[model samples]
Target: MEMSIKSDAVPASDKGFYKLSWTQRIGFGSGDLAQNLIYQTISMYLLFFYTNVYGLDPGVAAIMFLIVRIVDVIWDPLVGTFVDKHDPKLGKYRAYLILGGVPLTGFAILCFWNGFSGSLLYAYITYVGLSMCYTLVNVPYGALNASLTRDTNEITILTSVRMFMANVGGLAVGMGLPIVVKLFDPSETSDLSSSDSAWFITMTIYGLVGLALLIFCFTQCRERVVMDKSETENVKVSDLWLEFVRNKPLRILAFFFITAFAMMAIGNSAGAYYINYNLSGTAGELSIFMGLGSIPAFIFMPMIPAIKRKVGKKGMFYIFLITAIIGMAMLYVISMVDSLKEHMMLVYIAQFVKSTGVIVATGYMWALVPEVISYGEYTHGRRISGIVNALTGIFYKAGMALGGVVPGLVLAFVDFNKDAAQQTPFAQQGILWLVAVIPAILLLLAMFIISKYDLDDERIDQINKEIEMKHNNQ
Candidate 1:
């Protein structure tokens, strides 16, 4: 089959390599910012909310997390194929920014509502619905990057801006969430579990704001580098698996996504527990500690282009991954030493170091997804961006599944108690394992997985040029 480019669809200037304006880039990035605002809240706090506020046992919640991800394994690829084959009247990929974002916001808010309180069925419905809606938005939004342009530098810049905006949402949820929930909660108690109403209201506000951002993103993004209608019509769900089987870089990148996301999810879910039990910290302190996890983005994300140019991609990953491990070691040592426990500054410093590594290493990995998509297009003569993103989504969610399962199972083994004001030493140790030791191991594995990815910036650029030449000759 021959792939065709719509001669009249893109401007002459955008023919060979498309370049977007500042407005367009930010508009495109707002889609990520929006998803983070809604989903990051779920990732970082939903597990905590289920056990503490929503009144589920840690083991039960862990099982539910696993189930939800299992559902996604079936759901994500279907959403991907649907997005690739259909070009909506509003926009090809961007239409989902509204179509999916609407229900996603509703389910996100409902996921925090306590009317059902301890009802496991209600929990399954809302959580499953929320996860499905998120797939609808996430898979297409990911595809929007490759749909925007073929320029390698432009895609890099787009990924940088997207990650920066995404981290901003992370900071808001991490730092701002507890404080906002506090203001909305009527009780004076420091425990987050007692404030169900506050959690619901806070999610409502976040969900609405997230939906608005998705709309703005819908307005800003246009599909410029998509498959032709004829090519797209032949896309299928099996193609997702076929692509994974054939695409070596995609397979390697898929493993990296699992390790990277698993690392983040495990660490993020454990932060509140660590601060509350391990450190005997207050809500204010929890906010600062969690906020610091994303604060490094402001400092280091801007330096990504320069960092990549200086160290090259692999070298940068090595540096940051090592930096994260060193930070985790500091935390473990600080917790064990009697003299060091009292110095909050030392803890914060360790967090900053650890976060710098994680934020840079995990953040830049998004840039690689587009490269793998280009690789698929180069090999198969079709740009099935949605299918590629879906495949990556499955692996990343598989990583998240591990993230969701480990902490809960470990907590259950140690007899974690939500009703008690403080945990046993064994439980505290489990939280530490979740926060420091386990995540550090995953980062090590991520470093190894990324090493196997063979697509360099130069190689991807060559692929894009060759595809363009084939289209022109047609």
Candidate 2:
């Protein structure tokens, strides 16, 4: 598609800066790799860790997840504002790779430490600190996307690389967990009940790997499209509250991100329970489940740019949502059927299909943020990528909160006997619902919300042109 963006507004030099060198591309992708080890580790395993290792009841852990997100609601905007207001000597957003990343990594390692058995205070404190430190890095990294040039194609490519790495990291965490645990102790029945030695050792290694990635990502990433040194740093707290009211695209995208990530989080978090108790699968089954989750990103995510071009973003959402819904229905039905009860492969296949739709839909959404930030710049004349990212970060965390809370509440409500070797039938049904049905509903909600997303290609091209014109005139 031809773009009519005012060329004069974008300096000839800025166009070159839009695309990254191969080294830069690899460097940028590493952040997600790091985040996967840290953030995904927490999201996927924290509740399991709590119930199985830390000995917190599912109900209490659920409350703790909710509380952390509530804490995020307070920190997100403030961090966004802080980054936007200050001109760090190291860099705008990239510097946080070290500044915030070190603490973030340390706390992540500590979160898995089993020193304080049954200590809710330890769980709450470490998890909260890890989350806050993560926000300091994440909000800035997200803003870093907008600080790059306004080339939609380049941004799309960059987003693709970022998402690809994120999924790869996700794959490692999901699939690697069983492998990692097995390496430590091949015969442990439930990871929760395994020798505490195995769990602590496993997490320590993951924690160390996460720290290395954080450093690599920080060193590699640089903000290309920075602000004028003369630009005023004054940012009123009221401005962040106002940004939501005035920024319509951010509003739509933020809500879409929330619902979409929540769907994935909720579904992924519940899958282990469904497989273990509902399907009567062994630890070997985890490799298959984790594989299903990761493989689709490779299969489907690469097609996102092409798919977006062919069907338009809104049309693509509808198709994928339906695909996910069907897959989820099959998952629930297969698990419930008496004859099919032992055939876990059918459920795995359904999960594979459901994840194909979800991985693409959710992964591609990260590509859309730069567009919204561009729109914000065009409308408001301030290029505040950090603020925009923080808003979205708040929603993403909210999505994670749902993922964490829903399954916990479900398990708690069912009075899950985690201490038992085998779950009751009622508990098994609860696992099915948590794994398939609840997330399917969340996905449906996301699809409905995305239908209201009005950022068409033509409109975005226009916004870029206007932004360019503004820069030229300045």
Candidate 3:
């Protein structure tokens, strides 16, 4: 069975799988880079900021994270449906880069503010607003990937570029942020918890840079494969669920998103605690350790297209997922050994291995999104990219919610004392589990979820061609 639709005028260049120039590719990729700057800071540091620096209770922060994500569940589809149904002068997807980004930057900086320190109301207002604004930009930016072109190979390259740029942002936040905070500390203290002003300054810089990159992205990306205005008028919030129910590949990708992001979120949120308490490492060592997590993306992301071609998607996922699990196990074992516990080099090596596997496997999953979007267009006669991305966003945020909840719960369970200079032995062990075992388990589950994704490159190419043919006929 197939769905059909009458088409409005689509350009000759847009009637078939179009090729994007390097400039266009980089421009589009920058949006992810921009988002990573704002969002990764939150993901990696927000909980620590809340409890250690801003002085919120771990349990309270956990509840806040869950609440924020629940709000996203309601908000994502509305933004998705609205973006699909409305055509703005700036561009369908590109417009949001500025429309949503400017405010996103403001709220992102505010999330780190110490003005109303320990105020739950302040945290809720700032974090919730930041998240909604992020959805406004992110759902559209994801849809923009599918709007670019239909060539499977091109999409692979584009996804690689995007992930590479994203990791660059991760590096800045992961490695550079602690150093930046130290530089800004008035007391010459390396500890971020000692100075709220430093956190605010660091985020302000990151947020402003992100805003500039978003503007650049808006200027560069052109929406090529969008639903015509008339056709879009029929779009409804219900289509988000409708597409999910009928789209098999979307289902597989959505589940994979949940597990994959959960792994990253858990590991990232636990990193500071792992370094500060479990490893007894200094802030500099923690920066280096976290920095290593993103560094491997540079080495591995560029090779993704060639690797995928050689190994096949499922094979690539299997190899990398297993590699990540092995790395996680190494981390757990090394932490337990007194001799290895003294060796920061060993920890860096383990982190490099684990991050390599996790980064490449998860990074390449984004390329699959366009394939699933094409599948939906083929089966449903509508290219509702925004709706599809919104569905994926919900699952990803759910995974993020788990990331936020698990670490906080673990800390609370172990009686982690924010005021203590050193964590209790049991608390240290809980941090170890958060950083290693928990994330490793999530990675294993992610492998199983991705194995269910059946859309190979060849099949997707065939679907794209068929969809293009239908558009050309109309």
Please identify model 2 stretches exceeding 4 Å from their true place.
Answer: 1-11, 15-17, 190-193
Question: Which pairs of residues clash in candidate 1, taking residues 3 or more apart in a chain or in different chains?
Answer: none
By summed lDDT, which 10 consecutive residues of candidate 3 come out lowest? Answer: 1-10
Write model 2 residue lDDT over 161-235, tens digit each, in one string.
Answer: 888888888888888876787778645664323556666787788878877887888777767776665553666
* lDDT for each residue of candidate 3 in 207-245, tens digit (9 for 90 to 100): 999999999999899788888888888999999889999
Per-residue lDDT of 38 in model 2: 79
Off by over 4 Å in 3: 1-14
Residue 85 in model 1: shift from native, Å?
Answer: 0.8
Which residue runs does candidate 1 get wrong by more than 4 Å? 1-12, 191-193
Give TM per candidate: 0.97, 0.95, 0.97
Report the error of model 1 at residue 170, Å: 0.3
Q: Score candidate 1 by lDDT.
A: 0.90
Alpha-carbon local distance difference test for all models: 0.90, 0.80, 0.90
